[model samples]
Target: MGRWLVLGGTRFLSRAVAAEALARGHEVVCAARGESGAVPEGAALVVVDRDVPGGLDALRGERFDAVVDVARMSYAWVRDALDALAPTAAHWTFVSTVSVYADAAALGQGVDGPLVPRRESGDGATDPEVYGGLKVAGEQAVREAAGDRALVVRAGLICGPGDGSDRFGYWPARFARGGRAVVPDAADQPAQIVDVRDLAAWIVAAGERGLTGTFDASGPRTTLGAVLDEVAAAVGAADLERVPVAPDVLAAAGVGPWAGPSSLPLWLPASHVGIVARDTAPAAAAGLRCRPVADTARAALEHERALGLDRERRAGLSPAEESRLLTHP
Candidate 1:
């Protein structure tokens, strides 16, 4: 078994990675602020604030067989991690996003696709363009610093348990509620998602094998309608009825596309459709396995049940909004 260092392993994907590493009989050490949550059982936590200069000093001189960095939206943090730990880490995996691609309208592009102009520094904005630019920069930095040992995973819509985004989980939760739910009429829009567990497992396996290269990490291309139908099948209540509302009608009714409040999550605008339809064959061939949508739906529904189905959500339409749309549409 090898020693693994996971940056920001207290929550979500990073946490999943730590858990997977531990399950694989590896010695896991997670370095983070320790505020998000606890590290996985059997893993050691080295609390460090990456936002502070020299925050990673505690981890200096501690060599690791593999290191995973899930630095989101910050180029400086990516650079700092590389400067501090890249040399001592045998394998490095940097979690990046599909938004790094320049043309959101271009379909089926792979790792070699054109990327947004890289920005080594930004004002810490969370907008899509800024976020994508920062990721592009981070990818460049990782490849430049540790190309021989680097694995850049350009992940698409990641959904499953512990997903704070609330995008894909919304469907399962909504379907399980058993009502005339308002769904987007754009059923044919491309939709691709990956289970968090699958992604984390792949990352750990790749590190063990020293997998070096960039890959578009997502599931097979499928339509939004198929995804929704699968979710409904897996978790929908007996009385669940889906009402498809036209895009224009949804817009006029002040419903947002994709995510956030009053939005039909996973329903992307035409311009942004390509991000969900990437060619993930390279990753699939490299041992990135995705679970069935029904399986993901069941897991997500369980998580939603734990969080309470009626609780206010960060994404998806509220009960009042859903009712109004159903009554008017």
Candidate 2:
């Protein structure tokens, strides 16, 4: 067992990483504000606010066998962490997004694909271009500091348990409700996602093995229609009926694709279709395994039920919105 430091382990992917590390007999220390939620049961939480100068001063002298940083939108955070602890860490993993790619219209590109222009300043916003730019810059920083010790995971859409996006979870939840459901007419559009648990497990394993280099981390390529079909099959109610709506009709009706309110989750326009069709062969060849979509659906449905299926969501359509689309489209 090794000593591990997780930069933001209080919630979601970071939390799962911390939990996974602890499960593997590693001593895990999670550095965060401790606001999102508690660290996993066995991991220790070291409260540190990254917005302030010297925020990581508490762990300045500490050394870890492995360090995982899931710094979402901040290049400053990435730089500061590296400056503070990169030298003392044996293995470093930086969680980045596939959006870092420069061209979303280019499908099936591997880790060798071109990246978005680097952005040194991270404003902590949700703008996709800005987000991708920051991640590109962050990846550069991690590689600079850790060199061959770095594992950069350019992740695609991540789903399954502990997911808050409510994107993929929407299908299982809505299907389980048993009614006429509105789906995008994109039968052949590419869709790819990695289950949170699987991604976390792979990250831990990579760190343990001192894996280096970049990899596109996602599930095998499949169509959006197939993904939806699997989700419906795994958890749909007996009376569930899927109603497909054309993209143009959805556009004219003011509903967006991909995520957000009144949108069909996982449905992508042509220009952005490549984002979900990335080549994941390298990641899989490096021992990254993905579970069946049906397993993911069941887990997501369970998470949805825990969060209340009827609750307002950060992504996907509201029931009334879906009903209107079903009837009017």
Candidate 3:
């Protein structure tokens, strides 16, 4: 078994990766501030704030076969981790985002597509305009630090259980409400999302095999209508009324695409459909296997219910907004 070091392995994709590594009998060590959540059982935890002084000092003298970094949002974070662990870690895997792509709207774009220009500085603040640029900078930092030992996985929308973003989870949770739900008019618009568990397993497998270079870690392309159908089936919302509203109308009503407050998650504009239709053949050839969309939908619904569906969500149309749109339409 390999010795693995996972940065920020307390939540979502990071947590999944740590758990998968543990399941594979690897000795896993997770370093992160224990604010968000806890790492999987059987993994050692090192509490440290990556942005503060002596944050990475906890890793000194520790040797790891592989290091999976899922929480490095800025170039500084990557640089700091490398400074502390590069000599001790043989392999480095950086979990980047598809947002690093400059033009995902271009058809057939894959991992080889153009990337957003790197940012001048590595500020960790979350700015939507510069998010892609920041990620590009982080990727570059990792590549420079680890060279051929670096593996970059450019992941698209990650769904399934423990998805706090609620982007892909919104569909199944909305369907569970069992009423008139507002959907984008573009029924055939493609959607791309990979289950978190699937992504984590693939990352671990790649590290174990000493894979290098970049890979687009997105799932097979699927359509918006097909996703709704799966959610309907999973939630037993056979009688659910899906009100397809024009994109412009929804936009005018103050509904934005993807996650964040007040946005209808996964409902991108018509021009951005290619974002979800990204070519994943390269990743597939590298052994990325995605689970069925229905399975993801069902699992998301279960998780949402466990978290209390009636509570305020990070995504999806608010009940008031949905009611207003349905009534006005």
How many steric clashes between backbone atoms does each model show? 0, 0, 0
Score candidate 3 by lDDT: 0.85
Clash pairs of candidate 1? none
| TM-score for each model | 0.98, 0.98, 0.96
* lDDT digits (tens) for residues 17-47 of candidate 1: 9999999999999999999889999999998
Q: What's the CA RMSD for each of the models?
A: 1.0, 0.9, 1.5
Residue-level lDDT for 172 in candidate 3 = 87
What lDDT is reached at residue 26 by model 2?
98
Which lDDT tens digits does candidate 3 get at residues 104-210? 57766877788878874654456643777877887888888897898999898899999988778888888878878888887787888899999999999999999
- What's the TM for model 2? 0.98
The per-model lDDT (C-alpha) reads 0.92, 0.92, 0.85
Please estimate how well model 2 matches the true structure, expressed as its whole-model Cα lDDT: 0.92
Question: Per-residue lDDT for 14 in model 1?
Answer: 98
